[model samples]
Target: MAVHSNKTATLIVMLGALLLSSGCGNLAGHKNVDRGLSYIESHEYEEAAACFDAAEAAGENQRILYRAKGILDKNLGQYDSAVENFLKSLAATSGIPGDMDFDTNYYLADVYIKQEKYDEAVEVYDAILALRKRDKDAYYMRGMARLYSGDHDGATIDFNKAIALAGRNYDLRIMIYKALSSNGYEDEGKAILESCLNNTDPNMTNYEKGQISYYLGNNADAQSYLELARNERDMDKAPVVLLLGQTGEKQGDFNYAISVYKTFLAEDPDHPDIYNQLGLCQTNVGDYEGAVNSFEAGLALGNNEYSKALLMNEITAYEYAGNFAQAKTLMEKYRKAYPDDKDAEREEIFLSSR
Candidate 1:
C-alpha cells in the first residue's frame, strides 16, 4: 500500500527470510529458544536476551533467536542492530539449507533494501524468485530496489512480474507507474494512478488508494481512506487517531484536529502533545478560558517538554482574560522554571517592565 515509508518493514522481511532459512532445528535448540520466548512473554527483555544467547551458544535455534532480536531492535530504532542480527541469521543458514527460505529471504530482501544494499537485496530476492516463481512481494520489492539502483530495465521486469502475480495490489502498480514516468513515460504513469482510483472493482488496498489521493492533493479523500483502514483497530487505536490529528493540524482544521487529538488522548492520555494541541486549537477559536484550562490540565500532568513555551501560552491566555496579576505570577514562575530558555527570559524581562 502507501507503506508509511517505514524502514522497519523492509528490515523485518529480510530478517524473516534469514530466520526461516537457517533457524529450523533439532529438539534441544528449539527448547532453549522456546524458553526465551517464554521470558519475552513475561516482559523480561534482559532475561530473554540471556536465554536466547545461551540457546545460540549451545547450537540452539540461533536463527529464530536472531530474528526475534532483530525485530526487537528494529522496533527500538536500532537499525544497525537489526542488520547485524539479520546477517547473523543469514550466516547461520549459509550452506545448510542450500538456499534461502522465500519467507526469510523476503524479509532479508526488505531489510537490505532499507539499508540501501540494493545488490544484496536483489540477490536474496532473485534466489526467492527462483524458488517460488509466483512470489509477488519478492518481485515487487526487488523491482523497487532495482529502480533505486538505476537499473530501470531490470526494475521494470521485476515490477511487471509482480503485477502479473499480484495485479490487484495497487502499490505494485503505482511503483510501476512511477518507474514508467521516470523512464519518460509520464502519460502512462499519470494514467496508472488515475485508472486504479477510478476502477469499478479496484483490487488495490485502502492504504494504496489513500496514498494516491494524498499525493494528488485530495486530502479529504486520502483521510477518508486512511480512516477506513484504521477502523480495523488491531492495536491501541491511538495511532490512527494520532495520524488524523496530525493531518488536521497541517490543514489548519483546528476543530477536526481537536476531535482527533481528544480521541487519541482518550487512549493515550500520558502523551503531552494531545494536551498541547487541544490548548492550541482552543486558543485559535478564541476560547481563551478553555485554552487556559487545557494548558493548566496539561501542566498538572507534569510531562511538558517545552514547559516555558506552554507557560507562555498560559500567559497569553491570562492576558486575554485581563488576569494580569495571575499572568505576572506565571511569567515569574516560567522564568524560574526555564532560565536557560532565551525566549522565556526575554519575555519575563518584557513582562516585568509592564
Candidate 2:
C-alpha cells in the first residue's frame, strides 16, 4: 500500500523549481540568493534567514525564492516557517496542474511530517489528490501521513494506490518496505527490499543502497556498498555495520561478529543500543564475565527501561555459566529493583535451591 493522496514529492531531482525560469532577474533580491544558500549549508539558520529576508524585502516575490526559503527554514527545523514558504511557492505559481503541484505538496507534506502533524499533512495531501488523482507521490505521502497519524486502514489504501500507479520508484518502494517492517511482515518486507538494489543510478548514495541490501540478508553486498560509500559523517554506515555484525552472529561467525560489533561500538561509545548489543555479543561468545562488565558499563550511562532487561540478562548468564557467587549478588539487587517480575521471584527460588 502507498499514500493515495498528496501529489507532491520530487518528481525528478532537477525539477526542484519547476515551471519557473531563472530569467526573472529584476523583480527582487536576485543577488543574495547564493549567499542565503551558503548560510543554509553552514547550518547558520539565522544568517540564512537574514539573506532570504533581504531578498524578500528587495521584492524578489518569486516562487523560486520562496522555495529557497523553505529549504532554509526546513534545515533550521522551523516547520511552521518552512510550510509558510512552500505555500507561498505554490500560491505564486499561476497553476501547477500536475508535477509542479506535486513537488510543492511533497515538500509541504515532508515539513508537516517533521512536525509530527500528520493530520494536517493528510488534509494537504487530500488537496493534492483533488488536483491529480493518479499522482504517485501524492498517494505515497498520504499513506505515510495516515500511518503516522494512526489511520492504519487509510494509510494502507494510499500505499496500494501508489503501488498500483508506479511501484518502481526505489525511493517510493522503500516506503512499502518500511510499512511492512513496521507491521512485522519481516520476510515479505525483506524480499521487497532486496529487489530494490537491482537498478542503479549514480545519484543514489551507496550507503542508502547498502541499507536495502542488509535488510534483505545480503551482508556481502551491503558491505560492498558501505565500503564504496565511505564518508565520515554518513548516518547509514554505523547502522549498517551493526547490522553486519548481527548477520554474522546469525550465521555463526562469532569472531567476526564480535570484531564488527566492537569496532562499530568504539566509534559510537555511549550508544546505549550498541552497548546493549555488544553485551549480547559478549554473552554469545562465552565471555560471560565480559558480558557482565559490559552491561555494567552500559548501565552507568544508559537510563532506559531496556537497561533493566540487560541487567537481568547478565544475571542469568552469570547463573547459567555457574558463576554462582556473582549471580547471587546480582539476583538480590534485581529482585529489589523489579519486585513484580515473576522471573525475579523464580530467580530467588533458583538461588535458594543452589
Q: Write the per-residue lDDT of candidate 1 for residues 258-328, one digit (tens) a residue.
A: 88777767767775556766887888878888889778877777654645456788898887777778888
Using alpha carbons, what is the TM-score of model 2? Answer: 0.49
Clashes of each: 10, 21
- lDDT, candidate 1, residue 61? 62
How does candidate 2 score on lDDT? 0.69
**What's model 2's lDDT at 125?**
73
TM-score of each: 0.50, 0.49
| Tens-digit lDDT track of model 2 for 1-354 | 232223333222223334443455334555666688776654455687788778866767466677788887675566677787776666556434445556766788788887888886887777767667788878888887887788877877887788778844665667677776787655655665665565555666676686677667677877677667645464556565666666677677877877876786677666655566777888887888877777887777746556677778788778768988888888877765554366688778988788
Model 1, global lDDT: 0.65
In TM-score terms, which candidate is top? 1
**What are the runs in model 2 whose C-alpha is more than 4 Å off?**
1-29, 97-101, 131-134, 167-174, 183-246, 249-354
